[model samples]
Target: MASVNRFIQFNNETINTKMLHQMEMLAGALADAPYLKVTTRQLIEFRPSESSVSVSVFWRHRPKQIERNGYLSDIYLLGAGYWRHFSIRAWTKFKKASTELPNLKEQLLLCAEEFRLIEKISKERPGTADAFSVRESIYRDYHRDRYKQNKQKGFLADAFLNAAFLQLRGEEVPGSDGFKPLFFLWSGIFDAKSTRDCAIVVENMLPRLEYMLEEDMVHSYYTFGEAVENIPPFRYHEGIESEQRDQEEEIETIEEWFQSWHRETEISEAPAMEFELERGDSSYAEGGREEEGTGEIQQTAKGDSRGDHQEDNDAADRQTEKAAKQASGKFGSANNQVVYTEKRIQVQQDQRGNIEDWRRKQAPYVRALLRELKKRMTQRRQDVRHNLNAGRLSRNLLPLVIEERPKPFYRKTAPSKELDAVFCLLIDGSASMIDKLDETKQAVLLFHDVLRGLNVPHDIVMFYEDAYEASDAAQPNYFEWMHKLEDGNRDHAQEIVSMEAHEDNRDGFAIRWMTDRVNKRTEKHRFMLVFSDGEPSAYNYAENGVIDTANAVSEAKKQGIEVLHLFLSSEPTTEEQAAFYRMMYGNKSVSADSLEHFVEQTLRLLKRTLHLVIQSG
Candidate 1:
């Protein structure tokens, strides 16, 4: 059981996780990058390399709707505004031009460009004006307070930047009559349309402003082109002038930008060993037919119309192949570049004896659950027919048969239908499971035994990441198969007992990998049961891991595969833990406190899920 204070802390963490997930979805949708993640850091910026956006951590304390929307607006500005319109080349050029300027001046130039992007967003998305308005209101108040503090500390450079911010937003800066002329001169930034235009405006006003503000700002508050230089050069299609082509180019560039960011991270690390996984063929081509008179016009004119058609088909095929490769790359990242090592647990004589001993100890509970499941399945297959023309004759129906039709037979049973379902049981082998491993294995044994008795094809595997050897380039994950679908009714009690705690677990990646396998099954009903102790934890995958796992669960559900989570804990589950589980598994999650509870909950989930499968079938 958790203490009251600990419960409160868990509650807060759950809330933060939910909030982070919501923000991630919002940013990903706006940026049109579904894999994009959102997190809170010290500063607000878009990290294309990580495929993530960060909001300032300060916003976590402000719970008001205005503040919330203001931060949401910040996401929009970065995800949509900067991600879509702001060119990396232009940003790089601006950085080069500002290298020799004072820190204050450089910050002002960055601020100008930010406002220009914000203005563009307002014009394009009028509905977002209210959020941006809230943002402006918050920044004005923040700068005003900072201005007073900087002035009192005799930091003229910092105070001037604050004053300039206020003046740019049309707010008056007090006791700065001498600097009013410079503020007016810098106010032209509002009229600037492009980043270059903003830079020119800043450059023209910097000479006189530099003379007045001799001391450079003591602190740097602005971030311009934080990692833009790391991005690769944009590849533009020559002589592409159509609006649709331009839009396509922009979308492609944004995807490339994200890829480049990941590439940069990969380059910073040592070369990793490559692992391969089977992927499905592409279902559809991404883009439409190329323009008729593009570069291929001369070649097409040299050939007959039939040859031209064949050439077009060839081009489409190439495009589809390229799209498939791109999709495979994306899927690899989703797996966190894990090199999966599938091990078949080999039990020694002593281990086999121990496995049999444990199975004997758990035999009673397994039998009880198995009996209950069999009884329910029998009842589901039982049929009661009220009236029939043939089969068993009913004496009570004879009277009615004389006055009406001659229906005198009834049936008491129907043919039993075999279940058309498949099951996948994924166990978390993280170090935190050391204490609960015994109970978890017992519950898993029950699950396997009952499913095997019912003749259902199921798989059981334990997954974990090797934390000590994990790196940015490669994370080695192991999938220890206790029981495989091909194993049929073979009992693998020894393999189940062989399970031990490993280093860490990447829940999202593991879930997705299992989901892919389950998806390939031909069963009409599919189910994935995930067993874990707590939230996901892996290298560079704490908060994002939760969101990613939640997304994975949702994706599995969308694919018509039922996903249920069993949270195994040594102590009683608090309301906080339940809420946290709900975020990842929706309503299909159960937390077990004791050994008996673990087995009981697993039995109940299986019963309920199988009942649905029977009913639907």
Candidate 2:
């Protein structure tokens, strides 16, 4: 009993496997169908006006809790049956009739298709076919009675019910001439009175239908509307027109809801200054090496020397070769595997005035933050007067006079807070950031001025991929240094103002390179922050870039560097975006809805860090 329970399981995996098998069979069967294509992006969406349709990703997954007990769940079978009977022509006709017919034409079209599919399924999987047919028949009869009670002409609805009954029983129904042909398609396969007939039909048709579908030679059994009645309810077209208007109104309501959710916010920053930095051709220059001076002498000696002399020269040559190999090995060991090249991109001289004006406007904010940081770092000194005064406490000679040894305690001074940290601000210069460049510059300037005031070493860099020039042979990666840690000044503020969005972003490589830079710093605390608007995207980097960056972040964390990310997005983020951020940064990522929020968050982080530093000091 334990083993049996252990072997039994129910979950999405089981559901997906079954559904995937069904889809594969259907796809194989309909390889030649031109009206629709199977997809896993949406649920039962049929756009007859478009080239293909979409199926939901959840189609292959089901809740496990629903499959408890030994009860046989028909959910998977019903879904398979639905797709098995899917006919492009029927869907297209329905799309048209839903707009053209009033009362029951579109419903009739769907009913006819369902019957045809049920007949075909009876020949293959009778159990599934019967189950679906029963459900369809019950709903059909219910609708027919409802329509009759409402005094609506339901002639077509009655025909559909009769057809559904015939498909379910594989028997002729009385007074339904329009559904007789569909019944004949399943004649002699099963009987209405025998459950044994369903079992027998299933056993026989499984092999036959599976093979037939795989060969792609099975003729489509559905006619979509070949057996529909000639006349439907009265005023059918008018009813359909009314239904179409109602559907349109519902769609408009849905669109309004989405629009309300995505209402645009106001922009709060100026446009970035136009830069004059020319894109430089990044190419490796090869240098020539000089030949060894011993070349001629060694050759001549080897040629002229006789027996013993030749052996001596050969031995010397061997020693020289070994020494040369050692030297080359050392040089090779010192060579960098990934050579990173970076330079400061100069701003246009004419734009200096505009840059200065912007900096002045932002000066007050920077100065206030600097003052707060400096105040937090300020230290207090205490003094003590005594015989032996060093720093904080003094010696007590009175105790020595009372026969106790003279004990001296120095008056120690409290040490000032040391900014023992390295900060790396890696900015995404992807083209999507073109609109947010100005605000990004302001944030960068604030970071720079704060760190500069605290005398902390930090590097400001903008990294992006030249999407246009990138190729398999050469991946054009560009990184502009706005400020270097070694420079110790914000004189390069112009570079930040001149920053502009460029092309695609390869975040993984950039993070890795910055990680390497931070790893080299001597500071006890290392911090690297990324500012990006979206996922890591580039011409060949879309799918793998996210994973690669995540791995790189893990590597940074392993090296004791704290990696944080700022999502610089203006619009309300979707679930997909949130999931992506969580995957990339875990709990270390924060989102900013606008430029103002971005500034506020940055200041908050700075103040918190300063407070912590002050407390530690």
Candidate with the greatest lDDT versus the true structure: 1
Error of 1 at 375 (Å): 2.8
TM-score of each: 0.75, 0.45
What lDDT score goes with residue 446 in model 2? 77
RMSD of each: 12.0, 22.6
lDDT of 1 by residue, 75-127 (tens): 87777777766655555565576433467666887778678878888888888
Clashes of each: 0, 13
Quality of model 1 by C-alpha lDDT: 0.72
- What would you estimate as the lDDT of candidate 2? 0.51
Candidate 2, residues 1-617: lDDT per residue as tens digits? 00101233551111122333234234324433322223333233332222223343332333443221101112322233344334433333334422222223333333344444455555665555444544454445544454344323444434443344445544444445644454444343434222233323333333333332222211111122222221112323454766565542211221222222222100101111111012121211122123322222222233443223523543554443321111111111111111223656556556677667766876887788778767655642233334442443443446556745454545433644567788899999888898888778878877887787778778899987777776533355667778777566436677788788888887777887788778888877788889888877765564345555676677789998988888887776655556667777767888887777777666766666666655554
Candidate 2 lDDT score at position 32:
30
Judged by TM-score, which candidate is best? 1
Poorly placed runs, candidate 1 (over 4 Å)? 1-39, 64-68, 87-90, 97-101, 218-221, 232-334, 352-361, 384-416, 594-596
For model 2, the run of ten residues with the poorest summed lDDT: 265-274
Error of 2 at 277 (Å): 34
